[model samples]
Target: MDISIVLNLHDEAEYVSKTLESLEQAMVYAVKRGVQIELIVVIDNEKDDIGTIVEQFNFSVPSKIIKVKNCSLGPSRNDGISLARGEFVAVADGDDLVSANYFYDSFVFIKKLEKNKDRVIVFPEYVMHFDRFCFITKFVDSDQFSAEDFAYFNPYP
Candidate 1:
């Protein structure tokens, strides 16, 4: 497979559907380009009704639901990654909405970088949505920092 999308969900039943829909939109683009993808949702709440809703979505790729109880984000994500069968794994939060081009664009980019052994590419823009508004933040000329840079540079600052 080309990519495996791991979505970590808690009790955000109301928002999971929207997130899934956004993914479906991205999947449309990916399908056109013939990029293989899978959806892995690691949910902590079995009774949250999100599973029932997820079952309704006819995802082109295979999907898996891992049910756990009171799991932390790190462990849940780790579990999802462990189960991933794709060459690349993309992580998404259950309540967040992704752009329509996210999967397709990333798949293309990954194909180019697949020649290299290890690398991390960060996108320049991200949209932050609040209760009343949303803002798009773009990082111009962002450079890839190394482990040594992390020791000296305060990224948040």
Candidate 2:
């Protein structure tokens, strides 16, 4: 399968190296299971480090790093899309790791989701872990909601 991986990064210099290393392992696993990845890394312009990170590793691997000044998820995702040459794009943060099964399974599931023209997005159900507990929950598409809709919205910030 041919796929594009869009990684959104910002002022995460501390964790980005570990994150990228993990991503490299994940990509290796994906390729072994028949996936060709086009990695599009979109980084916020301020205090950039993605370039250094990509260079620190062996660039013999396939990937592209893009820098956008002060860009957020929406713009970075758009920027990634502009650079993507694959048929489908998978989303990830600069700090998240995908399970080994993610590539093989999501490839099957996302294909079916694409068939439903009415559904612009298909999200996976995730299990949340809090201090000593875990619970399964539905995923949220943040773009579909207003501040008034999310009852559990936190205001601590």
lDDT of all the models against the reference? 0.79, 0.69
Candidate 2 residue pairs that clash: none
Clashing residue pairs in all predictions, respectively, total: 0, 0
Pairs that clash in candidate 1 = none
What is candidate 1's lDDT per residue for 70-100, written digit by digit as tens? 5688988998999999988988887888788
The most accurate candidate by lDDT is: 1
**Candidate 2 Cα outliers beyond 4 Å, as residue runs:** 48-50, 59-61, 112-122, 127-157
lDDT of 1 at 118: 45
lDDT of 2: 0.69
Q: What's model 2's TM-score? A: 0.70
The TM-score that candidate 1 achieves is 0.81
